[model samples]
Target chain A: MATLEIRDLHVSVDAENGPREILKGVDLTVKQGETHAIMGPNGSGKSTLAYSLAGHPKYTVTGGSVLLDGEDVLEMSVDERAKAGVFLAMQYPVEVPGVSVSNFLRTAATAVRGEAPKLRLWVKEVKEAMAALQMDPAFAERNVNEGFSGGEKKRHEILQLELLKPKIAILDETDSGLDVDALRIVSEGINRVRSTGEVGTLLVTHYTRILRYIQPDYVHVFAGGRIVESGGAELADKLENEGYEAYVKGGASE
Target chain B: MAEQNTTGSTTAGSIEVGTAGAGAQLAGPGTGRTTVHQPIDARVAVKPSFDVNDFPVPTGREEDWRFTPLHRLGGLHDGTAAAGERGEDKVGFTLPDGVTAETVGRDDARLGKAGTPVDRVAAQAFSGFEQALVVTVPKDAVLTEPVRIDVRGEGGVRFAHVVIDVKPFAEAVVVLNHEGTGTRAANVELLVGDGAKLTFVSVQDWDRDAVHAAQHSALVGRDASYKSVVVTFGGDLVRLHPRVSYAGPGGEAELFGLYFADAGQHLEHRLVIDHDTPHCRSNVAYKGALQGQDAHAVWVGDVLIRAAAVGTDTYELNRNLVLTDGARVDSIPNLEIETGEIVGAGHASATGRFDDEQLFYLQARGIPADEARRLVVRGFFAELLQQIGVAEVQDQLMEKIDAELEAAV
Candidate 1:
């Protein structure tokens, strides 16, 4: 079992005028086998928290302590954090030209597993995983994300998540730009990993439609760069009806 | 040529210049629609000659020589490097069945039939070499294996000439491999007969202290096809020019090049595709990677479509990847068109550093930084390596590329 803890996490980004703080005194905790949905409006710094844990160079941790099973997550390099079982499914995955999907998956699997997988078994594993997601077998031969459609990019990110099998998986707006069919396919993929009961999921999004597919153990209403309220799955239904207007007004006043 | 003029008079007379990135197409009325005239630009009007005196010695100021380091040419630009005798081991050839190789004197009737010398070094090489190696394929024959020619230098000054002739309806592949150290100037001529197909590969794997300058010219007959792959990896200073011209309509040509420049290495490639016949097609793609301080690579692509050459199609692309600081790349693409009745014409050039986002994307998957860099660099050159068409050479080139990347660290 693994757990990720973020305490008083304050993050800032360099702006035209000066350094601007985005995440202000945010605190969260996610344990294995649990799904946490962080819902927020535009510019609420929800994605900031996702990228901060991934060690993105754009975001700086001003004052915070991120611990993954008592290890200093904040001090780890991006790849080191990944080797420690942390994965980030970016909102907009980058295009890597000339790198075929099959080669990329194999290389990533080798790095994470600390040993090369048997070619015969690995090929079967990839084919089965691709078929489960309704992906065409020919996609394995294409360059990663090169000229891929929006839905296809999202599917590729989920594919990586399924293969890497990280301890802490952060899905940043994975449901955005996905059609109904694609959303179901990607959600099913995540559920397959979740069913393993060895992974913690942090799903960040602006809409509650994804909640219809994957239920969360806890729901956090994010506003003004921090989680304003936290509750069970019932809080999501409240936000869907009451909206974030009350919290936004309160955050601005403070 | 007169028949083409008669046909050109009936078409719309206009000139168009299409800039790749700007998406700007400038069209204007052409002068003397029926009469095909060369552009007044001096750079495109240099007449081909066989005499050294007809071309002046380069002074590092000419448009063709400006990017080249004249001092590092080891006197190939002038008459200072005298021709030296090479041992029997200096040049070797492995020919397949139905292919013939022989050394002939300058009086041979087929010498210089493909092209005449366009520069002083080439002209000097033409007038200096006592013997030329000629490889010929019979008519209507297709060889299953490729013809290999290995040229090894033992540290001397030499001038050389080579000719490859493919008869009508014949098909063949040729590989010219260069290695070892020397100061050399040479000329290569390729002749493709009507309905014939030829694929020629020239590799410059010279020693680190070697200096080489060469010009390759190909003449494609009616309905013939020609493909050339130029690979340059090992050299202190190497400059090569590959030019193509069609003999009749329905001819096609493809030129592909790959180069890797290490520290203190200078590699340059200049190409020209002359479309003087109707309905001929040509394509050019060249890619290079530069690493370490003082590593430089230059690529210049020039394509000209005359007024009488109706229904011409051409496109050229050049891309460079800079692996480290202190490396320089100069890429230029020039397209001149005189007929508006063509299918298409375009060119593109881009030079960029290793993308940080790509590196991050790989690293985020647990790949180390150095391994990520290698993956990206290998991916950058993967497409061109496949075009080489030789499995053994491709594997060797990959190993060389990996070694280059290892040294960069």
Candidate 2:
């Protein structure tokens, strides 16, 4: 089982004005097969936590100690962190022209699995995964994210999640822009991966609607660059009945 | 007799496979532009001269020779260079029964009838050639095999002339492969007769020390179709000029070029397509990649549509991928339309380093940065490689490109 420990994490971004701190002092811990929901209003540092954890170059780890099973994650490069079993299903998947989806997936599989997947078997596996995600088989031949719709991008991210099989997956707004049918298909893909019991799911989103599809074990109310309150699934229900107002008022959080 | 050269042993697929639309995404001429850059200069005066003395040696100041290094020309422009001790040029042909090759004197009526020497070196070639090789395809004859001519140059300076004449209603493909070059200047003419189709491939894979300059001209007959593929690799300095003019209406021309330049190599191609006839069509696309310090690739495309050429359609695009820090590329595409009545006319030119986001997206998936880089380059050339109709040539080009990537990327 893998364990990720983020202690007092502080992050900043190189904005046009200067280095602006986004994550002041945040702490969270996630273990294998557990679902952690980080919910917050806009500009509350929720996506910042996701990107910083995944080692995005734009986000700087000013002061933090992130350990993945006692190994230092902060010291690793973005790709090294991925090799160390960290996956980030980005909110905006970058478009790579001339690189077909099938080729990219196969290359990533070869790099991560340490060898090329048997062509016959890999084709079947990818076809099945794409079917589960409701992605058209023709999509495999198109360039990655080139001219793709918003919902298609999200579905592709989930497709990678099902194939890469990382120890920890930080899904940044995977539910955004997805219609109800697409959301159901994407949620099913995440649930299938979660059913494997080898991945730690950190679902970062603004709404509790996705939490209903993929039930979260723990809910953390994130605000002011910190996880101010944490509770069981009841906290998400509370946030749903009310809103971030009770927590943002400064009493329910501390 | 077709004397085969030892350097011609490399199979058509062994050296380079290019033609890909990897640069299509980067082909835009940038935002909100109304005025075109430059017009095709018909008055530049590269007309073929019968006498070598009629053309003066260029000092690199002429419009056509501005990009060329006159010193690297090995005196082919002046008449100081001499032929090597190597006896003759080689030919590796798969000519069928319907095709014929004849070594004729310069006085032959067909010689210089299709094209004229545009520059001093071309005129020098026209004047100094001992004999011209004229290959002909019979009327209504569709050859199944490509007529292959391999010219192996020995480091000395040699002037030559060649012609491939396709008879009316005939179809053929001709490949002229140049290798083991010293200093060589030649003029090539293709006469595509009425209702005929011809595909011409000229591959210049000279030695690292060789210098080569050549002029290629084609005359398209009524309702005739012509296609040319120019692939350049190797050589210290190589410059090629390709010119096209239509003799009658309903003619079509397609020109595709691919080149890769390494350190200290200077490769330049200047193309002119004169739409002198009405209802003619032309398309030009050239892509190149440059690596190593001081490696340069230059491409200039000029298309002229005269007032008499109504209902003409033309488009040209050139793209360059600068793989390393020191490499450079200059691409200029010009179109001149004398008549307003035309189907479409436009051109695009782009030169840029590899896309960083493409690299990042690939690396994010665990493919190493270096491998990711190689894939990008391969994709950049993949579209052009697919355009090569011959499979063996494609394989050969793929292997050569792979070998280059192994050492560099």
Question: Per-model TM-score of chain A alone?
Answer: 0.97, 0.96
C-alpha root-mean-square deviation, each candidate? 6.8, 10.1
Which 10 consecutive positions of candidate 2 chain B have the poorest summed lDDT?
B19-28
Clash totals for all models, in order? Answer: 0, 19
lDDT of 2 by residue, B1-409 (tens): 1111123111111111122111111110222333211223454654445578888778888888888888888878767764443235666676888899988887676766555666888788777788888999999999887888887876666778898999999999888989896788888989899999998988888888888888888989999999988989889999998888887899999999989899989999989887768999998888888999999898988777777778988887787889888887877776666677788776777778888767766666677789889888877776676666767666766677777778778
Model 1 Cα lDDT, one tens digit per residue, A9-116: 999999999989999989999999999999988889999999899888889899989999999999998888898999999899988887889988999899988988
The most accurate candidate by DockQ is 1
Cα lDDT, model 2, residue B409: 81
Per residue, candidate 2 scores C-alpha lDDT tens digits across A71-147 of: 99999877777778888898888877656799889988888777899999999999999998888999998878989
Cα lDDT of model 1 by residue, B153-197, tens digit: 878787888999999999988889999988878899898999999
Taken over the whole model, the C-alpha lDDT of each candidate is: 0.84, 0.81
- The DockQ-based CAPRI class assigned to model 2 is acceptable
Q: What stretches of model 2 exceed 4 Å from their correct place? A: A15-18, A39-59, A147-151, A206-212, A219-254, B1-40, B43-46, B82-88, B96-101, B139-146, B168-171, B389-392
